[model samples]
Target: MTWINDIKHTLNKKCAGLAACALVLALAGAPVLAPAQALADVRKADVVYGQAVDARGLSVAQCPSIDAEYAFVMDKDGTVYFERNATSPTQIASITKIMTAVVALDAVASGAATLDSTVTVSAAAAAVGESSADLQEGDTMPLEVALKALLVPSGNDAAVAIAETIGGSEDAFVAAMNAKAAELGCIDTVFENPHGLDDGEFAGDQHSCAADVAKMAQYAMKNDTFRAIVGGGDTAIVVNRADGTKPTIELESTDELMDYYSNAIGIKTGFTALAGPSFAGAANNGDKELYAVVIHSTSEAQRFEDARELFDWVYEHELDYRLANSAQTATMTVNGARTEVPVAAEVPHTEWIDKTVKATLADPEASVRIFDLNGNVSQSLEFDEVTGDVKAGDKVGTVTFKQRNATIATVDLVACEDVAAPDLLEGIGIWWDRLFRGLSGQPQVASAVTLNETPLVVDKTAVAA
Candidate 1:
């Protein structure tokens, strides 16, 4: 959604770029284009539940056999799940563009430029080409469109243009890229050019590794604009020439992971005689999201397959533990009501409890332990202060489940039944009784409820004792 606004703002500034073209093409009965088509293949994975596993003692025998020279699989939060030669420094080729995108977007966030800001393709940039975004020398386009060209097609030219626009020159931009890598704790990463080209004048001692690339991917994916652009399959972009000619350039995604894996999220792909075929792939299976980076794979298609194997292996073997169930009740005191009311999960459970046994509510606590394949998870409960009338199923609080400080889910806590305020006469009577009790030096009793105060007793029927 944020990316949508970013694209719209940029397009609106440049004569309604995509949206306007879509309309014109539609009226003329040409192929209609929508930006969202880029994410058409992405969908949430079905929930898969499994018992917890103690991954600390996980054996190498259980790991997937991948074909890459170097590989790393990590959670979005930077938790490493699998690695092979992950720290070995090697030429990463165009995967270096990931950092290039990060630096450019960082400038946008810092107000140095905007998505609508124009970038001129210098002759030096357009001439330093390999994989192209169809940008020609002196051609100009918005930073947003340029990013699609840079990322989707792994455009070397677009990367140079962006670096010059954002960092003033390729040398300066490369310095910024290195600084960003250092800032992100990427020890083995070094950048020589914005395009990640490893030949000619662009070539140097530049290199990175699977571990460092994964770190960059994790950081870059936080930017919605960056994520949308990489995941966007193929798109048409409009660029302007000084002579007043506007040409639409169609950029096709180099990433082929979506062809076989439905949950594949676009990140980046690269190939060079030196770096071989490399891919930084991402996927979200239900609530779990992971990033897999493979460098120097046997082939371009094989790189994607390697990532697929990593993802499939993780989902099949890793745990998706159930952390907490809301079917249980909580007790809370309503200040102006007759007594404390019981609260349960706003969402109902299919399993039924005992009919005869009274299930008294207790103080809210996280009694269940659930594990995500990535790591351990903890929970925190927050409840609203209550007063006056309350209705059944009214939201009263929230139960947040977190894994390694990252929120996994938040479920609403709701009242199980109603609690009404006392009538005027009854209120007066209660106040009088309280005053009498206070004068008599008698300790007042506040109403309370407990779920554990009564234990369940089961024979033929399940009920609380």
Candidate 2:
């Protein structure tokens, strides 16, 4: 509630005479001279996380404090949860390798190269050293192995070799990296070289922001090869030489966060005189995946710690909203059954709802109103038209839950009890009763007898005897 009031106060003070002031107020869920579209788009009545902000805004007040100069957190789907100076251009150091990986993998995806294709280590690449894969000039290895070298050790040499192998030259590869950044909407990123070694002679105007690095990391992680390489930690790679000698090179991941954090999956680490200590980290909590970037932290450990804290805070805030209960029942008519069958969910269903921010579903089946931090829930129930006998636990329908257009859970609706078809005389009697009820405008009563197994046939002749 304070955040809402804070927004109002800030708007009155900071947003005076802004053209979109009314729209900003609307997005803050404040009643003002807001356009219909603004109110409709931003007002998510009750079920939203603490002081939810618009997609473009940050909720720094609601998030954990961190020491990073710039930080950003988002889900795999690009839903922003928290940000601090996320869009400001700053030194990113080896975090640039995330985009380098994206460009190299894109080349592989486009048929310009293959992971198995050979990459020759050039003198320029081998000499441009900071972190090295121990690759010598003229040594060759598969692009896959080169990627392992590049990402695992944060190898500057491997980055240049990969650039040359894929883009024909380092300059051209740098150009491709810039183009890919633009394509990914990384507005605050630029690439001056294949490796982010911009501390001395390599330094220039090259820079990126937390938000842009997150985008690159998200895109690169989508590639299975890239994900495996970054998360591989310590690994051994093989390279071929002109003298017919093959040797194994052991590489340890520079991104050491994975060593301690159980949920830590990937990304990269970076540090330079200008960049300080930085990290792009990712984690998976059940089916929910999140990415966080921390740039210009105090130290190597602090970078990882900053990311861990952000992840911990964000994941802890996630809520499991119940969508379906197996004990709850609904009634539906089925063919040949004596009465309407009681249907219930086959299992209890709940969705991992992120409570740190409000997100929109891509497609919603139905919508419900709520006054909690869980956001709007959309549910849809589909029942199968049935006729005939049914047993308890027989699936008869389905219920699906969604939020912000993303499906959170789905469960099958099942019968709660058995229903049997009436016997010959009973069927006749039921028809007569139905006719009488229709004529009298009275309700038809369901047969009281429940068949445990199968109905028994009656012997009318024997009864007469």
Candidate 3:
């Protein structure tokens, strides 16, 4: 009775294996029964089958409602991941300081000014009210220190002073700002002043689109000094005088994103009766970095809260990165073997990301390509030259998946088992088999033993028509 039970289990196991093979072969469109000698080929097909089965399928990013009238979330390349009135021209308030900093940095890069260069304040710069650095008509500081005052406190005075020092006058500086805007493809942008004030005396309230501000912030991050000043904490700066002495001055950063939020990076904050509270901020976690803007919110806290909510929404929908980690284990075929060898990534997926992406295995030894929703190949994962003697736990390949061309996950493909070289006689036998098949006018590799080429009926199976 025990022997009978063992036989039943064996038959059940065979039935299960055949059922799995049937499903796989059906999807691959081969349709034919897997020949007895084709066991390894069918097993190697698991690599492709595993990927298809484990695919994340289609995903849609569900964005939450932003409290502000205009908002934008983007990558460094200005690829917008989320937007609400992003391209529509509207008030950005003090985020204009991003462009101000950009124009100032460009001037420094062009040798027109240096971080050490002095910003001699004018009556015009000092007189401008609403969030002033309190520059008395003659106060002077280095261009570098002025930047800290401008960005940290969203100082209107510092904006005008940097403009005069770098652009000869605020009008000329505003023109330069517009030119830079055009160069950066800020199609809906226009600048009326170095600061984003409601200059009722000039054109209309100084305005820009959410998308334009995102572009400016992304470009500004390229400057080393800008990155340092923005990412640093509540700071004091020393201004150099001609006599080789330094005057120490302290400043406050109103950017709550930088001051309170742990993940927040350096950027500018702005508010007014007309423009309300607005923020252009960036945050990073692992490989997930984002630049976002929330403009015209009712209060300061609301805009920051909006920034957090928008970012959180973006994070929740990122299952593509998670899916890659799930299927690191797979199988591959050896050239002359009848069984499949297991393979995996030596390193697991550790990047935090969410984007619609796909990967395709071109061939056994060829690299796998990752594609975006636009069907563009965003990244390619390549494997090392793996020979039959590869041992278990050997490093075989590496896969680094990216979103917007930013690496979100890096995994090391590894051998899951040892595959020793075939015996000499076994190699000769394989070569002779290939030679015989080729000489007989068949393929270099013969088809399955069950192929119906012989054209006969047996045991009630089909015969010639």
Q: TM-score of every model?
A: 0.61, 0.62, 0.61
lDDT tens string, model 3, 1-465? 112222333364458788898888787976566656311111111111112212423222222445687777876655556666667778777788899999999989998889888897788888776776656667788899899888876678889999998999899999999999999988788888888776455348468888888888889988889988878856887655445566676665666565457778867777755666788888876557778888887567678877876666555434232223223334443354533322223322111011111121222233322222212223345655444455544565665545445664465555544445446776677667667766887554211111001111121111211
Q: Candidate 1 at residue 224, lDDT?
A: 98
- Model 2: per-residue Cα lDDT at residue 269: 85
Q: List pairs with backbone clashes in candidate 1.
A: 361-450, 361-451, 362-451
Model 1, runs deviating above 4 Å: 1-61, 322-465
**Local distance difference test scores for all models:** 0.70, 0.69, 0.62
Residue-level lDDT of model 2, residues 40-125, one tens digit each, is 11221211233335441423333355778888888898777767778889988888888888998998899989999999999998
Rank candidates, lDDT, best first. Answer: 1, 2, 3
Worst 10 residues of 2 by lDDT: 349-358
- Candidate 3 has its poorest 10 consecutive residues by lDDT at 448-457
- A best-first ranking of the candidates according to their TM-score comes to 2, 1, 3
Q: What TM-score does candidate 3 reach? A: 0.61
Q: Cα lDDT for residue 329, model 3? A: 31
Compared with the true structure, the alpha-carbon lDDT of candidate 1 equals: 0.70
